[model samples]
Every structure is written in C-alpha cells, then in structure tokens.
Target: MEMTFPDAAPPFLADAGWAGAAIEPIPGDASARRYFRLRRENGTAMLMHAPPPGEDPEPFLRAARWLDANGLRAPQILAEDTGAGLVLLQDFGEVRMREYLDAWPQDEREVYAHAVDALIQLHQLPPGPFTQYSLAEYQREARLFIDWFCPVQGLYVDLKSWTEAWEEVLGPLLARQRPGVTVLRDYHAENIMLDGGLDRQGLLDFQDALVGHPAYDLVSLLQDARRDVDPVTERAMLEHYITQSGAGPHFAEDYARLGAQRNAKIIGIFVRLWQRDGKPRYLDYIPRVWALLERDLAHPALAPVARWFDAHVPAALRDPTGRLGGTFAV
Candidate 1:
C-alpha cells in the first residue's frame, strides 16, 4: 500500500529533534492507527500516528507508561503530542515472535515457555490503570458474533438468546476476577516482539489492556487467530502456566470460557472488517477462529453458549469464507 505521513507527523518529529529523518511506513493492523520507522544518522525510533477522531494516543501512552513502570518491556516514549496523536517510541526492531517461530519451528516449546513465563510475571503484578473487564463488557463483545457474523452468513440468529446465553455462563466466572491482574487483550504472538531476547519480550498493541481474568491473555496467545499454534505446544504452555502461576484447578475452565468469548468476538470483528471497512483479507482467518471456538464450546463452562449455537446456526453456515454471501442489514 502506498503510504504517506499524517500532516502533523513531520512537524511533530522535527520538534522532537528528528528533522529530515527518513520515514518508512509500517503496515498497520486492524486498527486505524498508522506507524512509521524514523531513521536518523545515529539511531532509529518508531513513530506512531494515531490520527484524531478515529484514533487516540492517550490510552496507549497510559498503558505504555504503566507497563514500563512495572518492569515490562512496553516501548519507551521518547516524545509525544497527544493532541496531535503522534508519538515517537523506542524501536524494538523486527523480530516478532510469530515470524520467528515460523522460521524456527523447533524452538516452539522454548519460545512459548518464555511467553507463558511473561504472563505469569504480569499476572503477579497489580493491575494496570485501566477499567476492569466487566461482565457487561464481555456480553457486549459476545453480541458482535450475532450482529455481524450471522447477518453476513444470511442467517438471522437470535441476538437476545445469544446475549442471555453468554451472560448466564459469564456471570459466575466474572466474580473470580476481583482485584484482577492486567490483561493484555491482544497478547498473541504477532503483537509480541522478540527483539532483545526471550526473557524480555516486547509488548505491542497493549493500549486495550484491561484488569481482568489472567486466562484471557492465555487464550489470546495459545489460540491465535492469524496463525496456527501447534496443539502440543499449546497444551504444554497451558500446563506450564498453571504450574508456574499456581492457579487453581478451575483455571482451565476459565480459559475455555474466555477462549469462546474471544474467538466469537474475533469472528464478528473479521466480518465487520470485511463488510464495514472493506478489508476482506481478514475473512481468511475466520475458519481458524471457528475451529478454536468449536473447541471452546465443548468445555462444560460454555454449555449455554454451545446450545445457543447449535439451535441457531447450522454447521454449514458456521465457517464463513470468501466474500460472504448476503448484504449485512445494519
């Protein structure tokens, strides 16, 4: 994609003593935020352009500061102009965990071990400065599946029943998150940077951090949407986390609940990305996410949700593929 800096980006970089730095635009994720790598004679830094109205940099700044303060590896902010939505951050370099793992599949166990350890490390710390991931939030997110996914499949699923089913299962589990730990909502391999080393994993896209159940991030890691995580590696890491974190026996159940919730949300999001935003490429990941959701629904904790799915959506309509069939009536 042809990329250009936002209007305020140049002056903002110049004020930060990066005048005339070569700018190379970085491909963005599913968010409105854009990024560029700034290269000067001496060093390199990352410029995050979270444009106003659609995107804001304040939450990212707050999360970055909190993570760094608590000894995590969120990028250090060299300069910022929140009003203009521009931030220059420490460059963590190109070694993302997902890409690295693809190249060295043999290192999966060890690399995943390091990631599990990082989660244990974070869960032990006090929650970051973010709102609790409340039951309402969970329900609202779960509704996305019916709202977006069902319409695209040309199936008018029961939105009310979907909400009730999620709430029924999610309510009791919600109590366990009291005095919760920081949850990086998107803590998958793609958002993890392995620049320095495995021990010091660099966190990216953590602006959506929440104070919630520890299992949420684990689901994000082990059941990634973008790529397939080996089943053996996933099981080993989950066991490793339970052992190292000293979590209760019920932790596995909670992991399944959150997995169902997250995967369902992702399916809705991928559809929205295609139908609303005209980004159809995200549709390719729905099959993978559907498989994860199917496993999640099998767990007893998600029985209510499973029944809802069984009653409303047919197996043939479950996995949406290739430029969905019908118009999503908003």
Candidate 2:
C-alpha cells in the first residue's frame, strides 16, 4: 500500500494537520534530529524530529532568520511545535553541495568560491546570541578524548598533566583570536545545501552556532573531516578568502591553531559516537581526521598536545584500527 501520514504520523504531526502528507526519511547527519521530506496536496516541507530535553528547534529558527537577514540562505520556517519537539521547514531540496561538487568536479572552484563568499559575508556580521567558543569550551571538548577514548583503548590519562599540556597548546589561540563572529559551528561541505537560488548555497546544521573567532568555519570548510579536498584547491580558496575578507596578518596562524583544535575534538567525538551512541561508522574517518590533526600539530604552538598524544595514546590508535590506515585519500 502507498503510505500516507494518518496512521504513520506521530501524534504531533497528526495534530499539526499533516495527517495526509506523504513522507520519506531523509539521510541525517551525526545529530539526534531526524528529518522527513514531506509532501501534501497543499505544500511540501521538511519535518524535523528534534526530540526535546535533548534537541530544540528555537535555536535553529533563530539562526535561520538571522542568516536570512544577513544576505545568506537558510530555510524558511513553515510551522513549529516546540513543545512536541517538531517543526516544519521549507524543503530546500535533496542536493547537498558536496554531492553536486563530487558529481561535477569541474565546477568545484566556482562552487567553493561561492561558499567562501558566504563565510566572508558571515564574518562581517555582528556576533549572535550563543555559547562563546571560549578557551574553556575548547578545553572541555578536547578532554572528551581522555574521558571516552582512552578507556576504550586500554589506557589511563593523567588528567592533571593533560590539562596543563592543553593549556600550553591553547595559549597561542587564546592570545590571537579575532573579534567574535557568528561561527556556523559545522560549516562544512555536507552542511552546505546547493539550493538553486541566487546565492546557490544554503546552510544546514547550524543550530549549534557560536560566537567565536572568524577562522573557525574556514577551518571546517577547507579541512573537511568527511572528504578529502585537494590541496591546490584548498590553498586557492584560502587565499581568495583572505584577499576578499581583508583578514588580518595572523589569519594563517589562527587557522592552523583552530584546525588542530577542531581535529582533536573530532577524535573524541568520533569515539563517543561509538562508545555511547553505538555508532561505529565514525571510526572509519579517524584516519583522515588523524592525518589532518598531524598537519595541524605541525604548527610549533601545538607541540604540547602533540607530545601528550605521543606519550599516552600510542601511534597505532591514532588512525582507525586495523587496515584503515592504508586507504587514506591521496
């Protein structure tokens, strides 16, 4: 039987007058939020399943409007039932920019240029209301490696020593932060939607936006965890952004600092996904993430954390376990 929403719709969706909508689950990212691409005789929408007490749509709505006002593309809110942890959003289509670029690699430069321009525009906007991605937050995220990952690897972390090492590692980043901006905390290729609009770009997964250094999202784009961006292309995008944005002299240094910080956090997060969330798929990306982390640690300022990793975690565990080390993107 061709399914419709009446029987399948949850209590909330049925109450929201979507009882007859045709719905299909869309692939989701590494978030608790679930999505269903929905179509009814009246209109089409994307239904977000953000089970509250853990997920909320208010932040997403706020960030979306803010992005829309700032000359970028975020989805329009169709309807929201925050109390039931559900919201209906304008469907921005299924074509993620990553899929588009990969299918048509010839257009990568132009597409990435547009993405960079979006970041440049975002950097100029005044800070938004959110968690400040402060040194304390960075430290807290990095400690996830010690808390969740170490035990799984059959190792003990010396918290006191590790804390001091991170403090030293984070010193240069703290001292050289740019004025805060609304950092779309996960502004990577996958989160970018190829909405066929004037901007040709739409942002997703930005509910976790933060007030932090401008270079943070830049790192997220150029040093992607899920895909391998070619080095020449990556360099061109960086130079283009610097020229267009009139970024200060410390841009490269700050970028490397934040890149390493982000990659370190990924190590912990990937492990947590496996340990607590029962998702082992993230472990597959550890090799790529580790390679990126090594490059980040090449910055002289990050040596403390580098030394700490070497001392405790051992070299073998840095990459994915067993044969994953060999399949790295060249």
Candidate 3:
C-alpha cells in the first residue's frame, strides 16, 4: 500500500521554505512515522511526518538538540511544526554504518571501534533532559514478553512469578546505574550514519533516549536485531569500551543483565509488530534474538529470568517457528 502524506504536510513544508523540493519517500520501520528526502536545487533535507496520537516529534526534537549541543552528530533541525507533526532536517546522506560494513566487512572493526569511542565520549557528559530508565520502565519493557509473546503461543504462564523474577534480577542492575548516563535505546548499526566518515557518526532514531546504564546501548549495538555481528567483533568492542571508558569490574555482569532484558523486550516487540501491527517481516529476527537472549540468560545474573523461561517458555517454543504455525516469511 502506498503511504500518502498527511493533510498537514504541504503547508508545513511550504512554511518551512521547502514548497517546491522533490520529495522521495524513505522506507519506514515499525513506527508510524514516515520520512521523505526533500531535494531542492541548492541542497537537501529530511522531512519527518510523525502524526499525532500514535507518534510525537517533541522527544526527537529534544534529543536531537541535546546530542547536537553535546558535539554528537544528530541531524540539524531546519524547521518544525510540532502541531502538524512535521519537521525539516539536514540530510545526512545515504551511507549508514550497516551498509558501509556490508560492502567492506574488513571495516567492521574500525567502524565498531569508532562507535564505542563515541559512546565513551557520550557517557562522560551528564545525561540529557529525559526520564531515567527506572526499574519500573525496565519491568514495563520486559513484560512485553508476557503481554504479547506468551499469549500468542497459548502458554498461560505465571505472571506473578514473571514480575518477581524481573524485579529480583533488575533491582541490583538499576542500583548500580544510579545517576546514569544517556542511553540511546535504539543505538545500533542501522541507526548510525557515516556522515563525514567514521570519526563523526550521525545518530538517528534516538527519540527514545533515556538516562540509563551505559552498557544498554552497547548491547543494542553488538546484539543488533537486523544484522549479525560476529562474536569476536562483539567481544572485542565490548572489552574496548570497558577498557577505554574505565568502567567498573562488574561491567560485564551489567552487560549480561541489560542484554537479557533488552533481548526479551525486543522479542515481545517483534512479536507485537507481527501479530498486532500486521507487519510480519519483523518475525524473521526472532530466532536470532532468542539466541542472544539464551546466551544472556546463561549468565548468573539472570538466573531468576532463566528459571522463569525454563518453566514457561521451553527451548522448542523459544523460536517463532515453534508456535508461529510454520516457517516464517523470509
């Protein structure tokens, strides 16, 4: 189905002085927000349409300003009409980190190192004006597994125990992250733009930024849902971040804990995307995410969550194929 511009788009663009630009639609992710590349004779910009009720542009604007002010490379907002849910932004061009590494896999180490360095620099600063990723928030996200994935599989597990397990496991994790660093929740290869080379990575999709653990974003990067990061590269970049950032000795445990919580959230999210939102393509990533989650669960920190999974979600039902009725769409 073709996606049409919202009723407020034309005037919004015109008022932003982009009335006559050639508009090219960019592919969308799971969100309702739509993006367009606006090419005028002089230059180009990105047009974001985040229609209200389901999406909002204020958080994006806030995070973008904070990141740009902090010397990170977020897109410069050219103009915005928050009421109309439209924003004009400086174009970062097409070379993203994922595609760059795809063409030159040898560049993986270099690019990942640069990303880790960026995170190190980001963590040094105080967190932006955003809510902290509190224990409740982590629990809320983790419960997506119970809310979406479990019911779809017809497994009526103990919700009370699920809650207790997450609380027990995550309480200490949150305790260690007090007065936390800025965590760009969706930080990953796809959201990073190679605008001006690897030294200056352009950040995208950071509207959901929060004050949280530093290790969370690293997990998002190394255990990315859309692509497979080699285990060696994952470990190397992790150690690189720890050594360079002067993180605590327990950083590895924190990484495992966050990785498990994050993977569980993503599993529920992907399942919700397919079953509730009618986009089945996300289902393709479930098995990979399960693998990552399983590895994280093996860590002693996640023993409670691991036990819950052992009783409720068996290894057979862990993959989408087991309960999704057959082979998933490619």
TM-score of each: 0.95, 0.90, 0.96
Query: Candidate 1, residues 209-283: lDDT per residue as tens digits?
Result: 899999999999999999889999998999999998999878899999999999999999989998888788887
Better of 1 and 2 by lDDT: 1
Please write out the lDDT profile of model 3 over residues 38-154, one tens digit for every residue: 998999999988988788999999999999999988999999999888898989999999999899998899999999899999999998899999988998999999898888777
Which portions of model 2 miss their true places by more than 4 Å? 1-19, 41-43, 197-199, 319-330
Top candidate when judged by lDDT against the true structure: 3
* Best first by TM-score, ranked: 3, 1, 2
TM-score, prediction 3: 0.96
lDDT of each: 0.89, 0.80, 0.89
Candidate 2 differs from the real structure by a C-alpha RMSD in angstroms, to one decimal, of 3.9
List candidate 3 stretches off by more than 4 Å. Answer: 319-330
Candidate 2 local Cα displacement, residue 234, angstroms? 1.5
As for model 3, its CA RMSD to the true structure in angstroms is: 1.8
